[model samples]
Target: MKTRQALFLVWAACTALANHGAWAQNNPVLLADVKAPRVLMVEEATGTVLLSRKPDEPFAPGSIAKMMTVETVLDALSRSEISLDTTYPVTEFAWRTGGAPSRTTTMFAALRSNITVRDLLSGVIVQNANDGCIVLAEGLAGSEPAFVTRMNERANTLGLSGSRFGNSTGLPPAESSMTAIDMVRLARHMRTAYPQVLPLYTQADFEWNRIRQRNKNPLLGTIAGVDGFAAGFAEGAGFSLMATAMRGDTRLYLAMSGLASEKERQDEAARLLEWGFNGFTSLTVYGAGNVVGQAVVYGGAAEKVALAPREDVRVYAPTGDLGRLSAQVVYRGPIRAPINRDQEVGRIRIMIGDAVLQEAPVYTSEAVGEGGLASRAKDAVWSLLFSWL
Candidate 1:
């Protein structure tokens, strides 16, 4: 009979120090010179976004969609549905469209030749081989269209909501697209989920059918700690990149699009990544199992239930700017009882000024059962009294 109260609890205890270790007395780096129209940088360890600009705007993924193709194949390999040694034939259509005849990036796979998945993956990752992508797609799913269906399904499964695939090659006329943040998420997932496959991205070149081509990613060796990923360009999308770099204990993931030129893409990506590495410090706001707040429970034995994060709640704060940091625990209450222990009930948002830096899910620390009729009636009256507030 009572209306549920939506709770918004400000977590005053969430305070961070302005100066951290080596970053003392330093101001956060500004990204004014970076020319990309869409960009995002994330701290991989804390899952904190360090910087962003129009991260959700969709753009053609270009050859970067090959990352998803790689992910799909890795998923199949994990399920034992295929293996690196599995061979796929280079069909006439594949050779004509993406191979020697197409004059696009290719491994120059001979038509009707059987190539192992391992070599095809190398060709795709190291050389951005369009023909290799087609052969693998056709071999695995009987056709590229069927394979694209799987790519979209996998994107949904991975929470890449802003991504869609019409082809495995990411070439034009395929209708594939992704947002900057989505590409960063996909890059993060690939690194975490497929560690064994990462070396292929870093491989300098792949030699197939007596022809060798080097990896096209510009950031690979030019930046210290830069490891793997891809870069691409479309007619209207300009240039784009999905990159990851590591410096000792910290790692950063980046995605950017709509740059003016290849040189601009490389320079902007390097500058942004360097800024991410130097500008932020990790701030632990709440330790694991520390009760962050309480939410009112209706018709429960207990009046309120404690909430906490499953893991340590950490955020990346800009150097020398802790004054902008704040946090809040948000939940819809009075939560109806019989609540299960460890059930996810809400989220804690870490903010920097008006922008949300990161969010972590909060859960009920303990179970609460339905209360007796007398307690329910009391709760009903209490809810009614406060409902107007």
Candidate 2:
């Protein structure tokens, strides 16, 4: 499907297509031929590791290092420390240093030329301009080394334990390295907290001084629902991609680092995306105010109270997995009377593995009205109300 978002990803529906053998068996195993040891596919919302292969192991980040670059730039822009309209004077060094050495990312670059910060950002992101990356980095932090420090600092703040930054645009003589899990973590962070920055990854094309540059991501227009994210390749790093797709509330994010070939990476990523959706589901069995279960009452007018699957419990487990899912309700100590029907009497814990996926609130089923004088008197005398109700 063609999207107004610059046709960054597309799916080949060509006739006589291959029947993607994507379903990782129940005892899923990575292809024996797979060279990359790390791969991770996670559901962004819940952090469910759907499929993984040594995902925590660190590897070359390749141009994907630019992921951090884009993030730092977005942070500065969002904080108003800088503006897209702010212009930077392209010095001789900025021209000769960025991009693939001798090649500039944007057209506004010529000795002594001036380009706005917005233009430079577009170069770094939309055009994958090395020059733009250095300029934006220097513009914000006064030098690439300072900017690199800021990037690492941000990475630490985000809990990217396996990630580090050496340069703004990932290039040869790499000193930076990150794990696939860490890359997925970065993608998840961007997708959840900084979505406005997400569009930069899908920029199909960019223009500078009458020059046009197309995004290097081949999946943008070819894959359905593929929006923002990035792709990277280098002899040392092979090809890597961190991408997401939105199929309604069910959005899937996948990351593969250290692939042996471009085709393998895309094929594997697309396969994982398709499998995640086809084999899993999002079931919101409960909504706020929806009575889910009944809980026993104590010293109350009603014999029992209602419990709910509080906070809308949604799961991404395999189909039919919801049927086996279970919950445990909890609330503070001995129950009291006069409870509001909407009161959060307890919480529901949903579990699949050992982990408690989520906790939803459960409320009293009915208003536990105060007992009558006789009932109170009975409670005071025989203490049966607390036992009977």
Q: Model 2 lDDT vs. the true structure?
A: 0.68
User: Pick by lDDT: which candidate is best?
Assistant: 1
TM-score of each: 0.86, 0.72
Cα lDDT of model 1 by residue, 1-389, tens digit = 84666766646456444334345554555667558888888898888887788988999989999999999999999999999999999999999989999999999999999999999999999999999999999999999999999999999999999899999999978789999889988888888898999999889888999997888778988998889899988989999999999998889998889988998888888778877877777778788888988988889999899999999888876866666677788887779999999999899988877788888999999999999999999988888888888
Worst 10 residues of 2 by lDDT: 1-10
lDDT of each: 0.87, 0.68
Considering only N, C-alpha and C atoms within 3 Å, which residue pairs clash in candidate 1? 5-333
TM-score, predicted candidate 2 vs. hidden true structure: 0.72
- Point out the worst 10-residue segment of candidate 1 by lDDT: 15-24
Off by over 4 Å in 1: 1-4, 15-33, 294-307, 333-346, 363-384
Model 2 residue runs over 4 Å out of place are 1-36, 44-47, 100-108, 192-198, 234-236, 289-309, 320-323, 328-389
Best by the TM-score measure = 1
